[model samples]
Target: MSTGRLIAAYIFGSVGRGQADALSDLDILAVVENNLGKVAELDVIKLVPLQFASLKPSISWYGAARVAEMFQNGELFAWHLSRETVSLFDPNKFLQTLGTPAPYKECLADVRSFRAILSGIPPQVQQSAVNAAYEAGLVYVCLRNIAMAASWELCEAPDFSRYSVFNLSGLRKCPISVEEFDAAMHCRMASQRGLQPPHTATVSYILGIYSRLDPWLDELEELLLRKENGRQYAQNAV
Candidate 1:
């Protein structure tokens, strides 16, 4: 069972949240005494049962101390674990003892990082047939992560839902329509499932989605700035 070196193990993400479908891949974490941070797949893939190998569970390996540090720092990864992890193996209840993570404080920084990635992708890169689906996937991930981080910055509990983008405070000001965002989401999921239609206009559709991301990011940035300023104002007044 490899329990000698393994300290904690759990499933997280969609499956942890009970939002997964038949097509969803498992997100697993294995905390080992030997590895302190990220470990290679081969280091832990064999620990998974052969029956579940076909599902291709995405596994992560970390050292116990590293997990403690992440929890102490209140990173987004910490919040995710605190909010949505179901224990598969926890003889010592290590994760349970870690308790709630510190408040996430890098919301704006993360949003800006996501913005940089989108900008760096260049229009030509996004338009390429080879990168169209990949670009859409990146956008989907960025929007979801932005929403989660922004929620913490807004003094709200983090929103980790698949559709978290639509749930942000200033989401009404977001330029992207629900339908357009959803189209990209479907494309991302389809790509993950290796589904390519005989005839598809993925390039054109992803470009259209790209057009709206700029204004959407602008809206999020403005909202986050306002919140930060409001906090500063209250602090200065006191």
Candidate 2:
């Protein structure tokens, strides 16, 4: 139960990237030694110093050996930890020892993860405008990740800013406005805070955003397809 047992900890996601806003949560990963069973019993809030109480941390616990295995296997989650983390505690430099992740492979994994999330959305959840708006916001975030991956393949830096994908010249060909997209994102945050916008307005905004994103999704799928084909070809030739 002692915090002293933790070998390493890291802050990641928006906080690690220095992009936190009022609604952002602190995403934390803690590595421990020989206490995997005790993880569930630990009080995470108590482990966090009182100074960070306002940050609303979401914590995940992992054993040191498991983390090392994940890094060696090129798991996307481990890759993210290696690439986008600010070490809170690293007496052993465990995070530093992880090899650099393959960006293309990470991007493809993210695309698949996002697609799974979208596909898992129940039909009933979309019945409410607020719910639809929230779902649309998730979709927009996923699209941004897809755009970043695609951009990386083209030798461009990955842009993680919200809705940055819509600003791409290629995506500008699709019919969507900044205002409409913004509303969907706004509606999502507001809904979480228990403030719902008009149902009709929310639904309209979400529909518009989705319609515009459709073709872009198609393009992303094609990009992944090409990457997979090339990877298979290379493996076959070898």
Candidate 3:
């Protein structure tokens, strides 16, 4: 629990207080009374980006009892309960008390839904939108996809807008190749009309990575759509 407190105390915005529904950046505190009449405090901190869509960070804080109160009183606790890839401090017993594991299949379903939304983005927008618009949207959409995947797998979610992960060296291991991402960036940049392709060779290198990453998602996509079609077919059969 002290690790949770330390995370809440030291990590700028990880612990979110006040909002029953925790947003991107939050500091949360948990306080309980011991048999000895001493108060034990647990803090959980999380860093979430500002925009519901954007990948920017913000700060917030709260105590554990308050978080429990909110969960009892509000719908937002559902979000907290749903998160699987959280960086827990003093995770030992408190997490186990939170109860049975959530079905990861549900989280994967959410990821597949998010991917569908992304796939719906018009190719025309990809071809013509200004660089900033594309980058902004890309940061949101791509990171959400990545986050949902990590959440489903109960793995750490990378902060892609952060240079440490989104940069050339980092994305080499990502599902989307650095080359395709760069090409996408280039195409968006060149959509402005006067610029020449600055990094053609790198784009090909990236595309090669995309070739590897893209197919792996096929099963996820199929699982998602099959479920959807089944639901619809069942409705019609009814």
Using lDDT as the measure, the top candidate is 1
Q: Please provide, for model 2 over 96-163, each residue's C-alpha lDDT reduced to its tens digit, 9 standing for 90 to 100.
A: 77666443366666666776665544342456644665676565566556655555443344555565
Stretches of candidate 2 off by over 4 Å are 1-4, 38-53, 102-106, 109-113, 116-130, 144-178, 187-201, 231-238
Q: After superposition, how far is residue 81 of candidate 2 from its true place, in Å?
A: 2.0
- Weakest lDDT window of 10 consecutive positions for candidate 2: 36-45
TM-score of each: 0.82, 0.70, 0.36
The 0-to-1 C-alpha lDDT of every candidate, in the order given, reads 0.74, 0.63, 0.40
RMSD (Å) per prediction: 3.7, 4.3, 12.7
Is 1 or 3 the stronger prediction by TM-score? Answer: 1
- Report model 3's TM-score to 2 decimal places: 0.36
Show the lowest summed lDDT stretch of 10 residues, model 1. 197-206
Superposition error at 166 for model 1 (Å): 1.1
How far in Å is the alpha carbon of 48 misplaced in model 2? 6.6
